[model samples]
Target: MASFKTVMKSGHPPTLFAAFLYFDFCFAIWVLNGAMGPFITETYKLTPAQTGFMISLPILAGAIMRFPLGILAQYIGRKNAAITEMSVIILAMIYGFFFVSSYNDVLAMGVLLGIAGASFGVALSLGSGWFPPEHKGLAMGIAGAGNSGTVLAVLFAPPLAQAYGWQAVYGFAGAVMVIPLIVMIILAKEPPDSEHQSFKEHISCLFTKDGWAFSLIYVITFGGFIGLSNFLPTFFYEQFAVTKVEAGRLTMLAAFMGSGIRIVGGYFADRIGGIAVLSVVLLAAIGSFLALTSTPSLAVTTILFMLCFAALGAGNGALFQLVPLRYPTNTAVSGSMIGEIGALGGAILPNVMGFSKQYTGAFATGFVVYAVFAAVVLGCLFLWQKKWVGAWVGPRGKVIDPTPAQLQAAGRLEPIAA
Candidate 1:
């Protein structure tokens, strides 16, 4: 703790910036299919299942890679893990540009790009490991919010693809990422950890109650954020009968709010508290989700979209805040597990939405599913808050106040929960 404090006190602003970019690039790729997916679906003559699988493949690879990536980060250290992953992504995106000309080819590229997407797991552990419990919320929030790269994907890729072609857009992204990857490799440094755990012990944690709780909360926050970010543009195009340009514009605005609000969540977590903020935000998100229907009024729908994203984005920060509060000593393990599960949720939900669209022929059915899932998570939070938050201690060994009983039930109790 002393050593960690001394280095962090010295400032990790540069490392934080690099971490931010790492997240930005990974998220940008994670949802690449989001902006171009409709185009791909048309180009490939893909069935809904086929489209879902290809678009979500990166997410699945990212989920599977998380644990090994965590162990690798522990071995190579976070900075190197980041550099290697970013380098792999740059190479993958380039390959995608020139060689990917068929549905099978695009699927192959998506698999390779998963290397880029997996950086999220590495970054989450790395960012959380460096900061103290006191600063964890803000630190993780700023870095995690880089998922706004979804906005980057939507904002740039559509125009680029529309003009230069999708393949050309890949080339452009691949080129742009190289500069940041080089800068990150040179600038980011890992904070040190002395402890080691057996692989068996590390794997065992995933099945526990606490691990499940964190995973569930993360699904509500990150799952919803990623799933929606990935599929929202398509939703707008189908539902509102808007042009791709208008759809992309709306999607980008929501991603901006979602990504940007994470920092705000962090600041508040450092002050009034994570559980408090999380409670309000989750409730707001559930309401927004439920309120979102296929309404004729553009104004009502727009507010619902923005409000839903705002809550989900803030929830992303608050969940990480809860992670540090609950599992300070095991930030690497906790964060890795949390990220894996959250990303797995991301991979699954989009396809689920895709399937729902295929079957129901509308995004409203998908919205109902998201709303119900969020409500279930909210129920879990209430249960956890009631049964556990009072009994736990933070990484600093501080006795936190009794947070909402609902949160405790939601399984925010992880250093040992399940």
Candidate 2:
């Protein structure tokens, strides 16, 4: 087997440590409220709509900050930006414990936790930068799976809140985060090619058709993942009238499976192709959506989320496979843009589900919306086959050589690898 150092010079021991530490704190911050949501709602006497905001506001904050954070990574080294976010998350969590007095306090913490949410921007650019493209899927998959922070937070934080009081939960998080933050600062290094770009150049990348396509595809895959991540407890609460404890348990199960499966998805995207794997995952997600719409029994819902929706989990892994290939030279920019776009999906879908549940009283309508989005994605994959994919090649290598017209459109130079 090729050694890690052989495959990627940037994957130095120190930099890899930095990547893991940064993601650990960031993930903890993103899911902190979810873990504490039931307690906050009960304590504050917040309505369902307000509870929904308390759970989702962090995602919104994260989404809005991602673009700017992506731009920030370009100016500061990815390591600095990434570690600074972790430091900020530690502050946010501590502040919530010390300062949050009412529902407004929770809201304030959610907004501040956005700093943690934007960690994706840093992780996307920083982690992927540390490895050669050939190893990125699996390497980044493991790093991305730090999303298990949600699972960990929900698994531990809810129980912790029940035991020590919610204030202690925040305090514990703040204290726990400090270790990884220090490790990240000491171990992480800069990308050799960390070039700063002007805001115009960054925005210019966003304007391309490919960028929009990436955003749309990501919104569905990532949006659905995060939407369900935040809303799973709520969905269970409404559908089955389960206790909040039981609801968080169900969510924990799904999250564990979803996050654990990303490593497999990343491996396959490296072997089969990101598009091929994603195409199958999207179709499966459509089926899962239909299953979710019908409101099955408890055992069935668990199976639906953990077993059938495994594809959606895999799709998350598969999507990033396309990221590095899309811009080999500008991996940092491309990776960060993909993250910002993907994070946007995370922000929008939860809110959409919130309003849907508020007005219509069921998640069935949101199901249909996701189904339509999936179908459109499938159709576009077929229609654009000639342009998006005309050659058969596995992940990690085999860069696409553009035609003259394609060259002008992409505005990047890469050799064809077929």
Best by lDDT: 1
Estimated TM-score per prediction?
A: 0.88, 0.88
> What does candidate 2's lDDT look like per residue over 113-165, in tens digits?
77787777577567667676666776677667767777777777777887888
Query: Could you tally the backbone clashes for each prediction?
Result: 19, 0
- Regions more than 4 Å wrong, model 2: 1-10, 196-199, 390-418
User: Would you list the clashing residue pairs of candidate 2?
Assistant: none
User: How many clashing residue pairs, candidate 2?
Assistant: 0
Those runs of model 1 whose alpha carbons end farther than 4 Å from true positions after fitting are 1-10, 47-49, 393-418
TM-score of 2: 0.88
1-418 in candidate 1: lDDT tens per residue?
A: 2343453564577787788888897788767877787677777787766776777787777777777777777666788888887777778788888898888888777777677667765676666566656677778888888888999998988888778877787788788888668877787777654246566544555655766787888888887888777777777776677877677778898888899999888767666667677788889987887787555466678778778888988888877777756554456666777888888887887788779778877556767787788888888877776544555533222326545663333323234533
lDDT of 1 at 367: 70
